[model samples]
Target: MGKFFYARVSSKDQNLARQIEAFKKMGAADEQIVCDKESGKNFNRENYKALKSALGLRAGDVLIVKELDRFGRNKQEILKELEYWKKREIRVMVIDIPTTMIDIPKGQEWIMEMINNILIEVLSSIAEQERDKIRQRQREGIDCMPVKNGKKVSTKTGRPVGRPEIKKPNNWSENYEKWVKGEITAKKAMENCKLKRSSFYKLVNEE
Candidate 1:
């Protein structure tokens, strides 16, 4: 029976060092290691498909993964693959789920199978549920984007949330212009402009 190991990461930028190290620790040869740097949300993994086809699995062959999530994040998909492999008489060994190891004696295969089934059900359910929760949180966050770049966001109105546009004095510019053109004294400009000293200076400098 052939021993093969699988590893995965959700994205290309994600570090694969840890998973590769785990495979090495398990004595998986360089060629025995197959990795997919893609989402575990579905089975649309290229290297994963290649691994299956390349191995041409048969009875007694084993497929190993560092963890259950590395195998899949969807409950239905993970369960489906598990049953598929089982039917083909190929054992799936997950490092974290010790019960899945194929090293057990032939006589104890049934017991290990039962235990692995139970673990798979529980772990896969939790994985899928956690993934759903994370997606929900992400949707809610991006939907509203509570705060962005230190400014509260308003996706609906396309404005800063809770902050209204500043309304400058109606004739501040006219008065400032008059002051600049020497038509009005600084004191008169300040009186007519209806702006604080800092604001008047700020607007003047801005122009």
Candidate 2:
């Protein structure tokens, strides 16, 4: 019964003017605009969490975001949220990607739905990469140019100062061969397996 606009910036120092203007152009009232100066890695953001927590988000409520990344970076998480919103009959519109807005052309709902899903998948992956960049800058606490191959180089020393790569744990071949082949990182594999540091290595050594 209501329209909601979500705008996010990774930090307070960033400007929200453009997003605010975009929301107004989309006919969102000033009060309907929800701003979050936080990461899009998850939904733990203050304003975003409050919006989700609020009651009465019934069917037909429209949630608008400036960009797909503004929604979140994780592909699985984004798709899951989209499915949940769809089931509740909520309309999710990503302004930059018109295909994402399914409220148009009821006659071509099927086609639009297909295109929308593809866009969601593609955009979410790109967003995740962008989120990594944001986290990189955040960890450094300053805006530094990222060098070749996603390495953060030192401004003064002119040398790579990236995170130290972890060696593949034992049983990485048996338990998570994907990590060994470099399809995924050891940390990611461990997270996917839900293994604690001790337990994961214990299994590794056991093998």
* Prediction RMSDs, each to the true structure: 16.4, 11.4
What is the clash count for each candidate, in the order shown?
0, 0
Give a tens-digit lDDT track for model 2, residues 96-161.
998766457768888888888888898899999887887787676534555756776777777777
lDDT of 1 by residue, 63-151 (tens): 88889998999999999988888898888889998767657897887898788889989999998988899889967766666676777
* TM-score top scorer: 1
How much is the lDDT of residue 68 in candidate 1?
96
Q: What's the lDDT for all of these models?
A: 0.82, 0.79
Off by over 4 Å in 1: 146-207
Candidate 1 displacement at residue 172 in angstroms: 48
- TM-score between candidate 2 and the true structure: 0.63
The candidate maximizing lDDT is: 1
Question: Candidate 2 — worst ten consecutive residues by lDDT sum?
Answer: 162-171
